[model samples]
Target: MCGIVGAIAERNVTGILVEGLKRLEYRGYDSSGIAVLDSGAIHRVRRVGRVAAMEEAALAENTNGQLGIGHTRWATHGGVTEPNAHPHVSGELIAVVHNGIIENHDHKRDELKGQGYAFTSQTDTEVIAHLVHRHYVQDQDLFAAVQRAVKELEGAYAIAVIARDNPDLLVVARMGCPLLIGVGEGENFVASDVSAVLSSTRRVMYLEEGDVARITRESVQVFDGTGAAVERKLHLSDVSLASLELGPYSHFMQKEIHEQPRALSDTIEQILAQGFGASLFDGDASILQGVKSVQIIACGTSFYAGSVARYWVESLTGLPCAVEIASEYRYREAVASPDNLIVTISQSGETLDTMEALKYAKSLGQNRTLSICNVRESALPRFSAAVFYTKAGAEIGVASTKAFTTQLVALFALTVTLAKLNGRLTPEAEAGYLDALRHLPGSVQHALNLEPQIKAWSDRFAAKDHALFLGRGVHYPIAMEGALKLKEITYIHAEAYPAGELKHGPLALVDENMPVVVIAPNDALLEKVKSNMQEVRARGGEIFVFADLDSHFHDSEGVHVIRTPRHVGILSPIVHAVPVQLLAYHTALSRGTDVDKPRNLAKSVTVE
Candidate 1:
């Protein structure tokens, strides 16, 4: 949940480092700092807030250098104070910036303290600096010192280290976290994400787990855990800096919500043009031949997406599908089978728990694996046997929007493909599904047209402290996603339940001050959801219904209705998702919360 950027260049890198941190602001951070190797010493400027303030301080101090490292830290081991900010220094010799948790920091800190190493900050990252300094004192070699120090670390981390004594070199390592080297002429860079270095280089090499590298202005050398020299392929990234910009939108969340139409269109058009087959995923159709069931694992928004897919997979393919939250699944005992297709969903594709769960599943002899993700080069896709890439394109908002919709589109395609392979789908049925898929973008755009109304409804929610979301069957997960979005950005306490389950216990929480959001698509459960809406009304709960146009919901004193376009059956979830996202966006706006970077949340959850 942190950002790291390092640069070794012929020119001054202070501005470059600051720009990189700015690009990484979407990842979310409490404090930011930069350590530049100038002349014979390392100079660091750290601030306990945004990059702008740190940059201002750096500019005032004339912080400039040919080699430097920067960090935007989301606190894990310590408080969000300047003393705990990254670019943590050790004895004025070593400077380190790290992402991910160092699990054994306590023991290491105790040992180092016994050896006269003074700890300045209550951070695990500070241990790395001291550890490197301890080794550097012995060999007087920065690279060797870092290599030796990392061997003792026990948990996930991606770190970039620079020594004041070795200004010409930068050392980096990755284990269970993402780290990549940006390939540039007469320069090179390292970042936890490609977005950080996109301005200076389009080509990058991603370091694998347990890999360490030494970078200089001219070249890079990578070594595996065993210390053998290795080669990592350089990839030409397709991400554009313009796409990461907010443009005319006030916040990235709002822009992403509005971009769903284009995002869904791009994702669907690619599969349509390719004519979905084995080519749509990693392996050929042969991989699906023996898959009789599906097991999906994911975390956060991706988990909600998986919950939606469970309904699609079972109904369309006649497969017994199960969805589990990655964090819970990884730590518990479970039954694993080779016939169960291990499907993992994530936007960043580097979600720590999901990745660990996949590894755990594979270790249990579940060889059949598939990853549905947005980034093609992320660890999940690279490690899985098959992958379906979602072309949502650089989702910078901490609370996902386009990424969630695009993932649903991908999962729907996957379900149809599996159904065809299992002989469960007739050609006529496939054609109907494809037609519905093609019209999804237009339907979502029509849903977007309801934003003015949704924004008006948000004014009512601005004063709300609690919300309840209701849906039935497949739309139930959509309700969960809606509740999640509201709480994520607006900080309003929200919960979701199947409409049938409202009377079980949630009904007691409903009152006049409570706003209940109902997803009432014109599907088989429409009548049931309407009944549930009435139940809420009986309890004096304020109801906001996002219904299909043909549902014929009327606006009453206690019931406010916002109609979406005509329902497209299987694709209704994608269309319904648009309004709820807008509701959360506008509600967050009304409450004056940071819609893009919500407090204590990072776009990518790289740590457990």
Candidate 2:
């Protein structure tokens, strides 16, 4: 989840790199640094705090270089310190910034030390600079040296290497992580994501695994590992400052929570339209013809979205869907087959665990992998046999909102496609569902209006120390996601209990000091959730409910109701998510957190 940026320009590029890092500041980090090649010398500086501190240090040093690389690091390999910060250089032959881990670094470190390669820092990234330096001294070509060095690496990494020997060039490579090369009129750029190089260029070449590139001021050279020149298609990416902005909101979480309406609307547009244009949205029926099982792999909020999607896929398409937490899937050694349809979900598409799981599943015999990601030209999409792009735009907040809603909408589209393919859904059923899905935007908009209602009830939970989140069926995972959001940002003690599980043991924790925030959407399981709410109310616990008007849910002095738009049972999770998002947002705002850049949490987890 570190951010990396590199630039090769006719004039100084350090300022541009710094500005680009600022655009990526939403990606959490503890330290920031940059290394620029100036006058055949490597100039490096870093600070031990936020990106702003590093910017101040950059100005103080007056470092000027036309070719440079920068990194914002959330420490994993070593402690957060100036020495451990990125742009690690050894002997000035090579300077490197890295994201991800080197699992066998200690063995490699011992070997390199035996070879008389000294290091100044204790980072696995420092080993990269030394490894590159050793190869650069032998090959003299930075690109070849990087390729040879990367071939020896054992773990995940997206590395940017700069050399003083070649003042006008930089080398970039990616394996098990994301790296994009930006092509400009007279300059070229590389970054972990589009935000890092959006200031310099909009045209980018997303590097595939084992692909290496040498970037210069006037051109970019793509190469295969065997020293053959390769052609790369320029993928125009939708990355811009306007999408990254928080707009009228004070926190990005708030902006995202409100944007759920349009986010769902945008996703449902092409999916639910006239005719048989269901699957692939453009009427590509091939997506639904496969006879197989669906394996959903994801982490964090995206994982909750997957859990909710599994219910819909099984309900509508009559297909068995299994959802797994990406981090644990490989360890469990799950089985795969030719008819195995694996689907990976991620907002950034660069999530380390999910990416690894997707690759592992795709490589196992005959399996077709599909990715539902918001990022276009992302690593996961490139790796998948098929891709479904979610138009969630840029979700800057660490706590996801719009991305979750859009992913659900995308899954709904897939379910419809599958039903259409199997002849399971008649025209009447399809038309009604599609029409309801089309009006989902208006429903989400109605739900968004309840922000003020939620805030008014926010004071009721302000004095409470712990909260109980309860839901049934599909809403159960929404409860989990809500609890996660509350705890992640507010540092509050929260727990999610499936409504039916409340009386099993969690009932003992209920008291006036506990706020039971029930996801009581009016569905078949409404009575179960309502019973759970009553169970808490009997113990004098405050009841905060998110429900539809038809539940006829009464609002008492101790019971506060947050209304939701009436939608399908499966899609309710996506709509019900907005209020919980607001609850977490207001709770965190009350506690004063850097919502956009949460501490110790990166937007994308690029390592296990």
Off by over 4 Å in 1: 283-285
TM-score of 2: 0.96
TM-score of each: 0.99, 0.96
Residue 124, model 2: Cα distance from true site in angstroms: 0.7
**Candidate 1: worst 10 consecutive residues by lDDT?**
281-290
lDDT by residue for model 1 over 1-608, one digit each (tens)? 89999999999999999999999877756999999999799999999888999999999999989999999988898899999999999999899999999999999999999999999899999999999999999979988988899999999999999998888999999999999999999999999899999999999999999999999989999999999999999899999999989899999998898898899999999777876567788654466776889999999889999999999999999999999999999999989888989999999999999999999999999888999999978999988988899889999999999999999998998898898888888888988888898999999999999989999999999999999999999999999999999999999999999999998999999999999999999999888898888899998999999999999889999999999999889989989999999999999999999998889899899999
lDDT of 2 by residue, 1-608 (tens): 78889998888898988987887766647899999987778899899888889999889989898889999888887788889998899886689999889888998899999999987788998888888889889868888889989988999899999888888788898888788898998889898888777767789898877778888788888887566888888987776778777678888888888777777777766665443443463223354467467788999988898899888888887889999999998677677777766888999888989988876776676356778899887777777767788888788888888998898877777667777777788989878777778777887788778878877766665556788899888888999999988888887789998989988999999887888889887888888777777778888888888888778888896798866876445567777888888888887777777777777788888899
Look at candidate 2 and tell me the lDDT of residue 346: 90
lDDT of 2 at 250: 88
Q: Candidate 2: count the clashes.
A: 0
Candidate 1 lDDT (Cα, 0 to 1): 0.92
Per-candidate local distance difference test? 0.92, 0.82
